[model samples]
Target: MSPSHHGTEPVFDVTGVTKVYTSGEVEVRALAGIDLQLFAGEIAVLLGPSGSGKSTLLNIIGGLDRATSGSVLFNGRDLTDFSDRQLTRFRRDHIGFVFQFYNLIPSLTAWENVSLVTEVARDPMTPDEALAMVNLTDRMSHFPAQLSGGEQQRVAIARAIAKRPEVLLCDEPTGALDSKTGVIVLEALTRINTEFGTTTAIITHNAGIQQIAHRVFQFLDGRIASMHVNEARIAATEVEW
Candidate 1:
């Protein structure tokens, strides 16, 4: 779906956020003073190279990691002040994550793997329902090894979204796949964002993928270097480098 203009508060409102990792004689800053917002029903793409901190910012926003300083507000609540337990609960209740690698359990079938998370979610859709979103209903009974790379990634996407989370954070969701397979994965993601209205943030090295986002943020040296709205957005099926 196109970005909504119903005038809701931002899902994520971050300001001057920072993250630093100390290693003896050296200190590495993963994020340096970032200010950004992910509005409801918006698709944002984080475009940058290996050390640009795009993933670091995504992790913080998704509650997978904490910022070293500044504010991280989720719908007006200060996430920076949340306790570890609170952060855990927040992630469980509000966020879904998809990574580049298909982290599906080798022993479990697609349905079983997705079921594992839905069972614990507060208001989850059925495993079959989730699988259908990623167009994997026909292959739900297949084990991870039985599927193609794209199919496995689709299963992973199903597992992430089955919980009906308000936001979906994806870190290089197509990174490990070839362009043809990557297009299918991106299509799945675009479908999820449209059908569920899940505020989405994707981190990718492929600048071509920016065409699918409502807004594109370019990161460099641990900071956002540039950002722009894509007025002429295109479908993922039409994306090409």
Candidate 2:
């Protein structure tokens, strides 16, 4: 299938996208006229300090939020026009998300948590395959409280990928972990992107994580300050703290 049809074509096509929030009489411009394109089978890193609009852009693309103006197209579908119901369906069928906190259900075992997504997915991988991808096969029966921080994050990754979503969006995925543990989590993410050909986008303040990306975009004051293509990405394990 063409990338346009299956999100295999440039995974994202963002054009002149802008977001503005009005709180009483005050208006906050979270994104200012941004244009970008990202492709599948690659890892893209978004770098910026706090309040730089990195999170805003990620949210719009992931369908968690909407842009006030401009266009966001995934594959060829114009996301700007999608209704709330349509966005939910799109997110359910095509997107997976990871956040700084490992948002696992406290009552569920690792395997049970990972299996939740598959139950709602159109065509999903088995929980065992997803756990194995993150090297958490042995911890399937463990609960989140019983696992280490890194292990819990791996279970989160397993849950996200078990649905076999075409896109994986991560925001400050390692912010809550130590550098050493974070790298291990990143390795699992890298493995998922490489092995499944999932289009991956990561937002982080840590420049150290950029070494693993095929492309990097830097945001500043609600705009893209710079962008670069990395010919070679260093392994996550090789990144320096």
Candidate 3:
């Protein structure tokens, strides 16, 4: 049976999800019966240390990985039941991903790099529009090598959002940048969430970043340790690294 749908439902409803990896004789359980809900148009921060299963869950929700057991419901549809091809389609149509590493093509200009996704996207914004959203319109003609680390990352963000994915999953997006640059990146993400009403989930080990989230999920030892809502959320610029 599918999850019950309601008038106001979460974009993602993850229930009893688990991931177990087997390597020879060792069994590593990355997630242990995780039950979580990500509401629409809200920013959620998954705060945890390395190997705490935050990224594991994010991958599962983004259709990049599957749960070993249990179900992941996206808009009331079970993603766990989707085939590989269906998963690819789901990701293409509904999910955007960002990571710590800025994976920009060195040979392409920022505009060209973002255009790569816009070309195939069903209903994507123009590359110029995406770059403007990330405050990189001025550097759109520059190549990855010509830009700073933060600029390259913003270009990557423009590429991700160019496709206009409903959900934006970011894993350690600011892990490699300096505090100042990280704040700038955070501001871009916040602006995207606010302007486009994108359902954003950001995974970070930095506790200070949680202040910007509408909800915070703390993970430990492959499980959610606690969850809380931010009654007094702060701006991304005010986050203390």
lDDT at residue 154 of model 1 (Cα atoms): 94
Q: Give one digit per residue, the lDDT tens place, for model 2 in 201-229.
A: 99999999999998899999999999988
Residue 29 local lDDT, model 1 = 92
lDDT of 3 by residue, 77-103 (tens): 999999999999999999999999988
Off by more than 4 A, model 1: 1-6
CA displacement after TM-score superposition, residue 101 of candidate 2 (Å): 0.7
Which of the two candidates, 2 or 3, achieves a greater TM-score against the reference? 3
In angstroms, how far off is 236's CA in candidate 3? 0.9
Question: Can you write out model 1's per-residue Cα lDDT over 120-148, one digit (the tens) per residue?
Answer: 99999999999999898899999999999
Cα deviation in Å at residue 197, candidate 1? Answer: 0.6
- Full-model lDDT for every candidate: 0.93, 0.91, 0.93
Ranking by TM-score: 1, 3, 2
Q: What is the TM-score of each predicted model, taking all chains together?
A: 0.97, 0.95, 0.97
**For candidate 2, which ten residues in a row score worst on lDDT?**
1-10
Look at candidate 1 and tell me the lDDT of residue 9.
Answer: 81
